[model samples]
Target chain A: MTTYNLALIGFGGVNRALAELIRDEPQRFSSLGFELRVVAITDLAFGSLVQGDGIDLAAVLAMPRGSSFDGLPGGSSDPRNEEVIKNSPADIVVEATFTSPVDGEPAVSHVRWAIESGKHVVTTNKGPVALQGTSLSKLAAGNGVRFEYEGAVMSGTPVIRLAHKMLGGLELNAVQGILNGTSNYVLGRMEAGLRLDEAIAEAQNLGYAEADPTADIGGSDVRLKVAILANELLGATIHPSDVHTTGIQDITSDDVAQALANGLRWKLIGEARRESDGRIVASVQPIALEADHPLAGISGATNAVSFTTDLLGAVTVSGPGAGRVETAYALISDIIAVDDFVKGAVRA
Target chain B: MTTYNLALIGFGGVNRALAELIRDEPQRFSSLGFELRVVAITDLAFGSLVQGDGIDLAAVLAMPRGSSFDGLPGGSSDPRNEEVIKNSPADIVVEATFTSPVDGEPAVSHVRWAIESGKHVVTTNKGPVALQGTSLSKLAAGNGVRFEYEGAVMSGTPVIRLAHKMLGGLELNAVQGILNGTSNYVLGRMEAGLRLDEAIAEAQNLGYAEADPTADIGGSDVRLKVAILANELLGATIHPSDVHTTGIQDITSDDVAQALANGLRWKLIGEARRESDGRIVASVQPIALEADHPLAGISGATNAVSFTTDLLGAVTVSGPGAGRVETAYALISDIIAVDDFVKGAVRA
Candidate 1:
């Protein structure tokens, strides 16, 4: 039995939820033929905590918002993310830091440090994967470690792995997804006659949108995911900027009502398809979809990705796109993948 | 590079479509790091043909429906199903025989013979997998071979594989699905103001329903799939008859219209859930689902399975329920699994 020691790079909602799952459910990991032990945790707000033995996850999770991991065993108020990621005795590095769409920041560095340290990495951040996936993948391969990021796309709904592993032997032609929950919820509200600002405020109240809702509404979020999909699934080497992006910010109530009258529903669709000439064309735009379309009925904050394949036509998977435990489950599935790889390696 | 010699038990529309795929898409198999060669075939209509070398699939596929393989090399006018399955030099057997809801005869025997002969089996027949799945699985495992039947339910849509593989580490509590395309189509037609008989006749005209349409309308087809899901997914040892089934034959157009009036859609649903006491409860019934339900918007012959998981709330997969190339793709997917197993065994 292999018990993987993990170092969580961020103590945010997702990692905290992972700690919660470990603290709460014992059989969840053991039933999968392995166990997980968190030995190190580093966060910007809560600082760094490292115990060669397992950390008291429940206690750390119960810490108040302003509390820091100072004065405990090997604890410090400074978040030494680099030191903990590189030197910690961790077999797997769980990176749940915030997604920096611009530079693929410190999270990318954290991932690089862990891979360079010869540790398997599982991340829910979109920045590092969408921006520097190829390089990081090569580095992990050279170091004989895994770099998995299933949560980068549709939270815990299993989009990338479903396309890569399940859709094997079939030619996947294209993928269209409602990748963002906030924008989808806002559009559904618009269809229900709410104004754009009012819908955004409602989404904020529902904790679906950020304070600045620009990334969610302006298509940048979906663009990053499109880049990730194009690069990972379609083998495209283009950046996120290559995608022709147009979000739902300009879709008005009149447009929504007119679409409803014509038996259509306006949706912010992020689509990537390989053209006949082998060029991958990706875009994020608002389109009025027919009621019979696979994505038309994805209601509320739910997210869905529809894959167009040669054999099965349109296959869609829909689930919660973002949540604390949901995205944490993404990390868990990635670890499941990591365990599979580790077992295969042992067998080989 | 490995090439799998195949014995096609049924040269029906599905197997013939698979032959066409092998004949046309040469890159389809090669891209997946393997090759498929049909060396033997047995059909009730076209008789039996066996060639130690690769059989000319194009020639066999081009033959007329009434033509028998009497004059070809190693051809017989009679379908030597058991002989071909047990004695053919086939590394994998592709079974696409008729589904016998009654005792799972002939197909189950074919599967048993193949496994006993130490050959990997990939079947699209629901009989063996749904009815005698546990014993057949034990037989295959005892013989150190693979027995894959992804086509037994939601043909080529990847229901069983998706749930078992991608949703790992999450607690899947229940599965609710629109498993039968014919019944769902009839229900949709009823929703569009057609009577039950009229809807079934229209479905037959559209090639969605079989000629007799009794099993499709009487809920037996869905009962078989529910049994499969209950046993294979929820680990229940329940038979098809154990499921409390109620088909759409009793649902009137008035019921459909009333459902629509009350913001609902009537659908024939197959559901299997794990009770708190660890008992599996499975049923097939006509359900009026709200528009927001995951299985509600699955339109016109399309099938969907909504997996209720503990972490992600509900994850749903929707796609083609049945088709020639679609069901044929299920065989392809099974072959993919066979190759994986073969490679794993080789490594071991």
Candidate 2:
């Protein structure tokens, strides 16, 4: 069996969930003929740790909350992320740091360093991908490694893979979708007669929205997702800032009620389309859609993306947009993709 | 650039459409570092052609109706499909023959012949997959060749790829959706106040239903598709005859109107579920789904498959179920997959 060493750049919810999954599902990974072990973990709050052999995932998860990596046996305190990327015996680096849509900072540099160090990269951080995905893709290709970000847009929904693999040869013209689950859940509540603020409060209570929910409610999250889609699918270099975004924060309960009465429902839609001249136009806004529209029936916190293509008309895919376990699944899936790529290269 | 030689076992509407697409999109295929050439084409009615270099797809398309393959410069009149499979210099065989739900004759033997000859197989025929897919999969695995049937169910819609690739590690419990476009179209028309007979006639007029629409109307087509899904996805060895099927032919216009009045729509749903006791239950029947149901919104000749999974809840995929170009795209996509497999093997 092949063994892959992993370095996690952020010890956030997704990373912890992945640790738990790996600890719980050894048989699953073994059946696929691969063994994964974390060699290093770096986080802003929890600090960093590096071990040449492997870290005990279950033991790491059992550590008390707010404990630093130094507290673990045979570990050091707060090693720099760059040190882990440059020095760790890792085959893949997974970055799950908080996203920065404005500028793909630290995450972008971290991804680049990992690729340069000859390590495959898997990330849930949308910032780097939305802003510099195409560039990073080129860098990874240059280094003969993989840079996968399936969780960036729709958690573990697999929209990117669907477009790239399933719809491989089809020429897609447009992509319209509900990419933000928090905003979708809030809007669904507003349609059920709750005020916007009340809906937001409900979403926060259910852990669907962040404590500081501006990113989702302001449509910035979806803007970033659209930017990533445009860059990856349409071969267009687009930034989140390039999109004209309108958030759900300004949408009142009355607007939703009125739309419902008029045979439509308000949905926060993230859309990107290719113009006749091949220019890509992307936007994120609250739009009214008839009940029969592809994205209209997507309720609760589910995300859906519809790809309009020349040969196959329109194809839509919908699923859960986010969850700790769901996002963790994306990382695992990417790891498998990296393994496939490595195997293919070796076989080639 | 790599080159792939393809042989068509059935030169029906889908195969002809594929030839036309290849002729129209030469640059698209060439840009992907691949050149596809039709080396041989064998059909019972249209005779057979063999060109070791490459058949002129455009010239063949331009030929008169009912012309024999001998009319071409370097072709023979009616070489048997077996001869083509054994003697032709083909990397992949495209099988789009008529499907038989009862016993997968002809197509099953054709697929076996191709696989035994160490050739990759891509089929739009459902019969062999539903009946002998498990055996064929093992055979192909032994030969290190790909046996892809993306066009067998849902035309070119990408349901199988979505499950196999995207939901790579997820535990799927059930799949429910509209698998037959003809039944859906007929039901849609009946819901619009047309009698069952009238709706069937309309579907036939639009070429959505066959002259002998028994397979679609009686739900046998859906049964075959569900059988394929059960065997391929859930690892359940099920036959088409094992499914309990209920046809849409008995649903009257009055029934449709009543269902619509009750916020429901009549649809031909193909369902497969793995039981808690490790048994798999499959059925194809006319079911009245509520308006908000995931499968309810799919109208007309559209097909949708919603996979109920444990990790990400329900993931739904929808697209056009059948058409000349749509199914043709499936064949082309499968060809690419086969090429990837062959290339991977070579590299390995």
Model 1 local distance difference test score: 0.92
* Residue range B147-170, candidate 2, lDDT tens digits: 999988889999887798778778
iRMSD of all candidate structures: 3.4, 3.3
Local accuracy of candidate 1 as per-residue lDDT tens digits, B1-348: 789999999999899999999999979998988888999999999999999899998888889889999999999999999999999999999999899998898999999999999999998888888899999999999999999999999889998988888998888889999999999888888887899999999999999998999898889999999999888888899989999999888898898999899989998999999999988999999999998898888888899999999999999999998898999999998888778777672212
Question: In every candidate, what fraction of the native interface contacts is reproduced?
Answer: 0.76, 0.65
- On TM-score, the leading prediction is 1
DockQ of each: 0.61, 0.51
* Candidate 2 accuracy as lDDT: 0.87
lDDT of 1 at B215: 92
- With candidate 1 superimposed using the best TM-score fit, by how many Å does residue A83's alpha carbon deviate from the native? 1.2
Q: What local lDDT does model 1 show for residue A275?
A: 99
Model 1 off-target regions past 4 Å?
A345-348, B345-348
On DockQ, the leading prediction is: 1
* Tens digits of per-residue lDDT for model 2, A1-348: 899999989888999998888788977677766888888988887788888789988888887777888766546667588988878999999999988877788999999999999999999999999989998999999998999999998888888977987887788999999999999999989987899899999999999899999989999889999998888888788778899999988898888999988979899999999999999999999999986677887878889999999899899998888999889988988887887888773223
